[model samples]
Target: MAAPLDLDQLQTFIAIADTGSFTRAADEVFRTQSAVSMQMRRLEERVGKQLFEKEGRTNRLTEDGERLLAYARRMMRLNREALSALDDNRLEGSIRIGTPDDYADRFLPEIMARFSRSNPRVELSVLCEPTVNLVELIRRGQLDIAIVTHDDEKSPSEVVRREPLLWVTSANHMVHEEQVLPLAVGRPTCLWRQATLDALDRVEREHRILFTSWSATVIIASVLAGLAVAVLPECALRPGMRVLTESEGFPPLPDGRIGILRGHSSQPEIVEALARHIAESLDNISLPAPEDTASFDFAAMNLAVRGRRHKPGQMAGW
Candidate 1:
C-alpha cells in the first residue's frame, strides 16, 4: 500500500498555489525559502509528479499539481474538522457577518460551509447590505466582520480579492450601441456608478441612468431585459449578459476590490477564524470570463466577479 502524503508538505503546497510564488509561500507558511524548496522536492518525489513550473517570475502549477490541489485542500479541511470535532475546547458561539447581496450568492456558500464544518458549534449570522452600510455596522459594533468593497480613501479594509469590473448588456440586445446609452446603476454613493459615469465622460460618451437601484437583482434584471447596460464585477455576470469592450466604445475600468473589515467585537478568535476562511475561499475561486462573447476582452479587466452588482450606498435588495 502507498504511504500517506504529508500534511505539512501539503500545507506548503497550498500556500505556494495561493501565493503563486515559492518565496511568498515560505513567508505565508513561516518557513525559509530553501526549506520550502526542499519540502516541494520531497513532495514531488513522493507523488512522482512535477507539480510546478516557472512562468516568467511566478511559479505556475503543472496539470498534475492542479489535480493534487483539489485533494490537498480536501485533506487539510477534513483534518481540521476531525481535530475540531474531537477537541474539548472547540469554539461554540454565534458570529455575525455582513456582505453585499452581490457576493452572498457566489461567496457565502463556500465560506459558510468551510467555517461551519471546522467549527460545527459556531453559529454564523449573515447580513446583506451595501458596503457603506456594512462598514458603518462594523464600526458601530453591530457586526463581527464584514465583506466589503474596498475603497482606500473611504471604507478602508483589508482587500481579500480583486477582479475585473466590466461593462455588461443583454446578450440579445445592442443597448450599448444606443446614441445616449441607457444605464442601470446604483445610487450616488455607489463607487461603480461614479466609475461608470467617469469612464463615459472620459470618452465623451453621452449616457443616461434609466434604471437606478442598489439591488443587484434589479440591475441584472434590467440588463437581461435589454432595458439598459450596466457595470459589474466579473463574478456578477449572468448567462444572458454579454461583456462590452473598448472596441465597442466602452473605456477601461478599475478592478473591483473586495475586502474584510473586523469589528470591535468580543469574539476576536472566532472573528479572525471566519476572516481567514473568507480569504481562503476567495483565493480558491478563479475568475471566469463570459463564454458567449468571443470579443469580450477579459484580459483587459484582468479576470474575476461573483454575479451581483454591488455598489456603495445601495442595499442588496434595493
Candidate 2:
C-alpha cells in the first residue's frame, strides 16, 4: 500500500518552493529550519522523487518538484477554502495591507473605507511600500494584502493586474525634430524604471536620463516644466499634462503589468474578502481611460499602487 501523504508535508514542500529558502518556508509555517527540512525529506520519500535541487547552495524546485508544487498549491487552497466554509463565525481579527506611493496617494482610502463599512468588526491596517519592498513584506507576514505593479521579469510569483507603463514629459519639454527627450525617473530598482529602460533598449532608442526622484510629483512637475520626459502610470497625471504618443523611434512601452500576489493561509476568509474588496475597488476607480483622442480613467483599485497614510492625492510632508 502507498504510504499516506501528510497534507502538512506537502505544504512544507510548496512553501520552500515559493520562498526558495528553508528558513523563509519555516517562518511561513511556524516551524524550525531543521523541522521544515525533515518535512520536505518525508514528502520527497512519499512521492518517490527528488523535489528540490540546489545551485551552489541555493535551493530551487526541480522539474518534478515544480509539478508537485502546483498540485500542493491547489490542494492547500482547497483545504483552506473548506476550513473557511466550515468556520463562518471565526473572522474577527485585523488584516494589514500595503500599497505603493502613487496608489496610496491616488486610490487606497476608498477601498479601505468600503472594506471598513462592510466588515466593521474586522479592523484593517494599510501600509504603503514600493513593489519590491511590499512583496518581501507580504512573504514575511508583515502585510496581508497589497496593490502593486509586478510585471513578467519582476514577478516570480502571482500578479493581480497588468496595467500599462507610459512615458510622461513636461508639457513644455523641448521637442526637437530629431532628438530623443531627456528623461527624469525614479531609481533603477523601480519596476517602472526598469521597464522603461528595457523598452528603450529593446527598441534601440537613444535618450539621456537627466535625473531621478522618488516623488512622482517632482518627476511630473519637472516634466511639466519641460525638464525631461518620465515614464509613469497615466493615473498619476493630473489635468492639463499630456503624454507624448509620437516619439521618433520609441513604440509605446510594453509588458509591465500591475498585479497582486498572495499565498494560502489558515486565515483565508479575510484574504478572499479583502481580495474581492480590492478588485471591486479597482473596478470602480476612475482612471483616465484609454482613448484615441482622450485618455480614459484607467484606475483599477486592485491594479494600482497605494500606501499607509495615503491621502487620496498626496502623501503628507512628501
Candidate 3:
C-alpha cells in the first residue's frame, strides 16, 4: 500500500496551481516562496511525477498537476463541511445580497459579520452599485435581494430606508460673483440627474455635469475637492462637504430609499431574512419630506412629457 499524502502539502500545491506563480502562491498560502517550492517538491516526489513546467518567469501546472487541482478544491470544500453542518440558521445557505456602495461599506460589513457568526454555513455575495444598476440587477434576477433608493413618484417596491437628498459641494470652494456651480452626476440611469436637471430648468439654475461617474466614492471625492456640486443622501455627507443650495424651495427629489428586491422562486426564505436584516439595520423607511416638495407646473409638465414621447418634433422646448 502507498503512504498517506500530507493534507498540508495538498493545500500548498493547490495554491500554487490556482495562482500560477510561486511568489503569489506563497503569499496566498502564507509561506515563504522557498518553503512552498519545497512542499511542491515533496508532493511531486510522492506522486513520482513532475507537477509543473517552468516558463519564462511563470509556472504552468502539468497534466498531473491539473488533475490534482480539481481534487484539492474538492477536498478543501469537503473539509469545511463539518463546520458548515454545525452553522446557525443565518449562515446555513447561500445568501446573495446587493446594496449601494456606501451602504455596503458603512453598515453591511457589521451586519453580515454578525449574521455569519451564528450561521457560519451561509455564504454571502454582495454587489455594490448605484440605485439604477441595483434595481436593474434585481429585475434581471442577478441578485436575491437589493437595497435601492426609493422612487417617490411610485410606491411600487418594498422600502427599507428613507431620508432627504442634500445639495452638497466641495468644502474648499470659494464664491465668485455668479456662484459657478459645477455638478457631479451619476450616469444616465440615475433619477437624481433628472431631478437636478428639472430643478435647474424650472428655477433657471445654470449647471452642467463637471464629471459623470457610476462610482459613489469617485463622485464624493470630486465634490470634496471642489470640482462640482452633487446631490446625495444626507447620511452620505460628512463634515468635509458643504451644503451649497440649502433653500426651503429646492425641488423635492426622490427619497433616500432602500428597496428590497427578490429574485423569483429562489431561496425566498433567505432572501426574506436578508431584507429583514436591512430594514432592521437601516431603521424605518419613509417617503420624501412633504414640505420640501416643489410646486410643479403639472399641466405644462405632462403636456411636455407626452408631447416629447408621442410627437418628438412638436414639443415646445424641442
* TM-score of each model, paired residue for residue: 0.84, 0.57, 0.56
lDDT of 3 by residue, 220-283 (tens): 8887776777777654665456554424234555445555666673678767656655554454
lDDT of 2 by residue, 85-190 (tens): 4565746778877777777777777777766655666887777677778777878777777777754565454443444556654443354222765777777778
| Of candidates 3 and 2, the better by lDDT | 2
Between candidates 1 and 2, name the one with more favorable TM-score.
1
Best by TM-score: 1
Stretches of candidate 3 above 4 Å error? 1-91, 152-155, 175-179, 245-254, 284-318
- Candidate structures ordered by TM-score, highest first: 1, 2, 3
**Could you say which candidate leads in lDDT?**
1
Ordered by lDDT, highest first, the candidates read 1, 2, 3
* Candidates' RMSD to native: 5.3, 12.8, 20.3
